[model samples]
Target: MLRFNKWSLTPFHLLTLLLTLTLTLWLLNVCFNLPTWLLLVPIALIQFLSFLFFHTIKEKGNIAVVYYCGYALVIFLLFKWFNSMAITSLTYTQWLGSFMMVPQPVFAYFLSSTLMLSSMFIALIYYFVIIHFRPMVLILISALPATICIRMGRPTVSSYLFIFMGILLLLYMYYCSYEAEELPYTVLPCTKSYWSTMSLLLLCIFLTCSLLLIPGSNLSNPIHTLLRTQVTNHLQPNYTTSTLPKESTATSAPTALSDTPIFEVRATKPVYFRTRGWDYYEKNAWHVKREALSLGYQLPKSEMNQKLEQKSLVLLNVIERLEKNGLLQDMPELTHLLEAPISPITYYAAYVTTLNYSHYMYLNPPGLISISNPFSPLDLYLNALEICFANDKTRPYPNEGYVISYMDTFPASNSREMLLIESLDPSTYNQLINFLLDRVWEQHNLQQAQEDEYFLKKCSDEMETATLHFLDIPNSITKRTYDLAQKITASSTSTYEKALAIQNYFYNGEFTYDLNSPVTPLDKDAIEYFLFESKRGTCVQFASAMTMLCRAAGIPTRYMEGYVCEEYDASKGCYIIKQKHAHAFPEVYLPGYGWRIFEPTIPATENEKSPLSLILLLITCLMFLFILYFLSKVLSEQLWRLWIVRQEPKIALEAIYSRLLKRLKKNGYVIEVSMTPINISHILLEQGIDLTWLTEHYCKVHYGHCSCDKTVVLQALQLYKFLYHVHP
Candidate 1:
């Protein structure tokens, strides 16, 4: 048997253990949403026993085997419990599907058990294979939980604290490893050198601050992007799939409206928040082929129309304010506001939850605006003012809100007259154009410079171009769609009238507005299915049908997806937008104006919640509060202990004394509950150790009722330092 000397646990060892345990508990609290006390107390007890077991055992090989087997057992038990609960089934496919549908409690239970088992596995590795753990390995181990928290979107103050502590632990571990190698235990140390440790810590702090100052520092790193993508992909399957509308695509299974609030906006009036647009239509999907237009602060002459210059300036001022207030530091778009042109109309919005999609939310014709945080590089397409984040990077939509100014254009006031003129005979059209030009010249009191002929030609060409753009549709469009379009518009005499006829066909209770309707099959046409087969669908289906009908009727139309804020809350002083508000509508491009908003879906009542849903919600809230209370209790206890260690000299003296005994036990020295400081000191002295001064002072303060002063506590600490350098 190899005789191992009992090692004294220094203040460093005690502090490190406490910090690591606290950090572990905090992470578990955040990630699992469990009661901290439920996890902390048992974990602390087990860690204490494990440390003692490893320290007292003379055979290192036995220690390795025992620790590994213990962790393996724990992992086995976790799986057994999970299986017994029926949270996961036997087949892989069934297991995955069931896991995705697991309720919060079961999910939390599963995650907590997994994390705990992971920690134990890491510990096993550290003790068995990697007996001489490197600082980098330790840092990586410490970062695992924090990484999980970030990936799960549960970042908390504790998560950051864990990172900071991990960095400090890296420095401490490096110092320990270096000191052990350089200074032999037999030699008395001259002095402790803290300069290197302090210098390294300061350098790390400086670098962290510098990184924050740089734009996209957190997101620009290749390591961060890779890690985030891997974690997101791994975990996304376990979460609920998003129901938000995507670019015109084959419809998926219908989903219920989530009562979860997404964002809130304070606007002068209700407006549609558009995120994406589709220009080209396939059999069942809409696609966009145009590349994004990159614009900076200076607007091009063509895009500068509609008083966008003034709007851009207003957005710039808001961005400046947000930047000054530290709210826009991460908002890359706001930082480069001068590079993009925006409309003059503006509103303020704040996010209540993270927007899962990469697209930026704006009104139908989004213009220049300021966001509260930075994002990854964005591509802004001109058609429908569509914005999409670059796919090469992973830019999640920021949870912060922004004050945005946008421009909105309504249909031309004379659109009706333009439609009538285009339908008139050629000689009648010429006469009408001449009459309009003469009236315009007379009203402006302008000189006749062949102005009537020029005006007549310009108006005719503009209307003709607009008509062709809006009416362009694929020849593959079904015969059924063409027939329906003609039948709906047959009674109408003008373009605007034809568009209205199609819109009214869907809106006038002709089709059922069903959010829970089955999806249209991929092989079938979505418009045909919605219009003829199902005759029941949500806004996306309704909008798709109307857009196809209008396009077939020679009216220019595009599919648009956005949020509609129909219900305003006066008490809140803002419009509350929820997942249920996600809407899709058709926009018809009029000849002389722009795309006009036309609603084809009839308004539907809110979905009534069943008693089971209400019960589940109540239970969730109760569980949240219950866990929160225990977490607060655990934190308060730890804080109190820290306060006593720092502020109370008598208590600090006692704690140091207790740590000495723990050190003796760790070093293979037997300690009894009845052993006094004097008895322990005698045993140490017999083994060529001296802690006489510390023993005497501790005894006086604890038993003799002698007051512990600052000098006395300092003397005890000084005496205890010799153990750090002594060898058995």
Candidate 2:
């Protein structure tokens, strides 16, 4: 539940908050290795703005959460569209493809995303930590970034120390807030509540220490060890290491994917985990060439290390020179960051295989940048077109699969990039890639250029070969197939447009997607049969047909087999990949850019969303609760009245008199907690209010222990009216 309350910002509150935020962020900067002043200044702005917004709004209860969500959305859009650092003429998708589709995210891009994230987090901390003082929630927020950095291996182990201390201080503040009654619980400070609070405080301390310390990582504490092993293993998705043995073929009998979950994946977004890419089509089958199968080249780690070491020195010199010229204040890693390519369009995904298949290996999605396993260095095989593990080689795979950082955006998926790619001369993108390569060669490490020049050269060589390799169509391709491809793309100008045209051809309502299509006659070519005769097929058939057409249309195409995970488990915050999610698609090479996927599978219709359902549900829940609360209050009052009336006459008289004094006390007449009715009468009389009749009856009922009747109660009521000068 969220509440927006206008807080009285005392000096204590303001000072402590400033100190806490500065310390926490500075500590976090230590963990993240981000520039300090840049992060600090922006977050302070966000905090001030957020504080003003919340302070202005006086709404309370869960309705405030809706406001916060809307506010968060506005912040997201503001940064997404208006961020000048990374903005270019490219559309969002195009930008993602061209600029971010690199090995690592560039400086400004990383900072922009981080700043957006921090803005929202500051709003959260202001609400939960400052306004509410929820220690559990605050601790969770602190642990989250630290956990991510640890999982990604971005921050050093020593960085956890800063995070630990920062979180501990914040938690202590929350504890103090509660003790001072600023965030007192519904229950008062009784023995039970005292013990509970103490227990909770101890738990918070332990958790803060344990998470930052990474207790599972070679620790002596048995409790921490148990929590690490028991809790994590239970929550982790159990995916078997054995991959589903589904073979891709142009000609095969109809088949359906199995429901058995062969692997489980945990990723923020849905993606295609491609096994491999097929180059040529012949004899009614797609085939991988020898070059495609072989690992083309590997970069020596020493070369990367050497380049980094050189870049560091060069960057330092540049910063120093700029500082001497009064051009800049410091490097703070800014020089190297600016020289880096645009933000790499990638996010991290971690998945673990359930059954230990002796070797642990994750089926990383296409467009993978790097991967990591828990125990061993990743045993990987790569080529220009695609990547996979070296299955036959002697290498250790993590027993629990691995984590991958990947980006898999298709340039043709967006209109602007598609048009741009289409309009570009075939050699434009290639030349751009070459220019970047030579630019690297000309700068920094010019003396030992060959040492750091493997990947770009390999990509260039592969590009030279892809033309002859990917266009080799089957001899079985009929004249009608070529004619259809030509006819579809007759109006389309470029290779990207032609690929889209081919893809659109299958998505038209005339074609049906059938997983269990009848077997192709052995004599008929499968592509021809599917186009003219069957006119129905699974993803394999549709993708195969599209590939064949694109190839005939003089576009380089490859058959790609992969599993597309769509089923998202909101509970676990990851996607679940099953055997039934297997899919096949064609990768059409966009000259200079690289291979881009075109979907020819059955078109998934758009399902538009409306906020009406959620609004209605929320309204209903609140209304029901309001009515329930009203009824409960009335019922409790009636029960209390009934109980008092059912007492003995003497007791009833006293109770009746007690109500008059309670009313008198509300109007500035002083009364003691354990005052006699006579004492209250005297106290009220001094305030020019008399309750003598109540004093007499209450004395006779209690002190005399006499048999009092309804008349005494009646007298007390009359006196109560007279005390207020009302007619009875």
TM-score of each: 0.43, 0.41
lDDT of each: 0.51, 0.54
RMSD from true fold, candidate 2: 20.9
Over the stretch 96-145, how does candidate 1's per-residue lDDT look in tens digits?
33321221234534444544543563354334312443443554565766
Model 1: what TM-score?
0.43
Global fold similarity of model 2 (TM-score): 0.41
Number of the top candidate by TM-score? 1
Compared with the true structure, the alpha-carbon lDDT of candidate 1 equals 0.51
